[model samples]
Target: MTDKERLLQYCLRQGDTHIIFGYRLGEWCSKAHILEEDIALTNIALDHMGLGNAWLERAASVDSEKRSPDDLAYRRNEREYYNLLLAEQPNGNYANTIARQFLFDVYSVLYYSELLNSADDTLAGIAGKGLKEVRYHYKHSAQWVVRLGDGTVESHKKIQEAIDDMWRFTEELFEMDETDDIIAKSGVGVDVSGLKEAWKTQVSEVLEKATLSLPDHNLSRTGSKTGVHTEHLGHILAEMQYLPRAYPDAQW
Candidate 1:
């Protein structure tokens, strides 16, 4: 495929990923363990959704597609989604959710940092706007990770379990493919592989400060990059797409 085509596909895939994951995260709004956390989760969810809208609009413009952002987000099938498996993993417990968010926020901050220097002006602009939101998300999640990991015995245990359970899915975040190759070469994106070392350093340092051990288990899961996802995505998509799918062209 041509460079432009590859770039467009990458953008669309990334946008779809954010929308689906954001919709999933929104489910935690009033369901969090505490009021402050609940509001925080929802606010971050809005940020994700907002970024998704920008990316999707750009993707549609690039492809000259007629579908609206809502359509692209809600109408797509599960197999068409490109989000990492970690995002779709069921929010098992408070600690589990925080662990997932912590890791994702780390990667996202790094990803957007590189994107700010993108050769494509639109992508750079979006990244610039997104960096501020992501910075807060990372800080919030990092603080929680530390608290949960270093808190009471029960909290520590739960957070460690979360870290262990979620660790495997992190491999996908740094897994680069042909789409990454095109974008990196074109200066429109960062190489996922290049981000891996820095991500590892940051994550490991946080775990240490939190008094959490690095997961000894070495088995890592992948595949979401190519649209392969876990079973959880089906349910997430069903809930997220219900309004638009059922109502068809209805808008607020």
Candidate 2:
């Protein structure tokens, strides 16, 4: 594929991950255990949506077909999406949601940090703006992880379970494919594989502080980069795309 195509795909994947995870976090609207957390999660969800839209704009700018970001986000089939498997996983419980967010935020911080200096100006700009938000997101989720993991007996158990279940999917965040190879070679994409150790270190330190043990596993999940995703993505899309699909020509 051409560099434009690779860049477009890269932007869309990051955008999709932000949008999907934002939607999952939004599900906690008015549902968080405490009032402060309820508002905090909502605000964070908005940050994700805003970041996603920024990346979508980047994608649309470079797309050969000149597809609008809205069109790409709402009009594509599940198989056409490129969000990470970890982003698409169901938010089982509060702990599950926090665990997923924590892991993703850690990766996001590193990913954006590297992207801040990308040869592609658009990507670099987006990263520069997004890095600040992701840092805050990481802090929020990491604190929650520690709170739940090191809190009461029940809280500790549930958060530990979340850590185990979500850890397997973390591997995919660092997976590289031909698209990544081509884009990175051209200085527009990140070689995510190189970010794995740093991510592990950040996660390990947080888990230790939380009094949680990282699971030892040899297996990891993949395929979101290639448009394959878990069933949860379909459900998320169904809900997220419902209004646009049902009223294609309608506008607020």
Point to the candidate with the largest TM-score: 2
Residue pairs clashing, model 2:
none
Candidate 1 Cα errors over 4 Å, as ranges: none
Residue by residue across 144-185, what tens digits does model 2's lDDT show? 999999999999999999989998888898888888888888
Cα-based lDDT at residue 33, candidate 1: 82
TM-score of each: 0.96, 0.97
lDDT of candidate 2?
0.91
For lDDT, the strongest prediction is: 2
TM-score of 1: 0.96
lDDT at 123, model 1? 93
* Clash totals for all candidate models: 0, 0
Looking at candidate 2, what is the lDDT of residue 50? 94
Give lDDT per model, in order: 0.85, 0.91
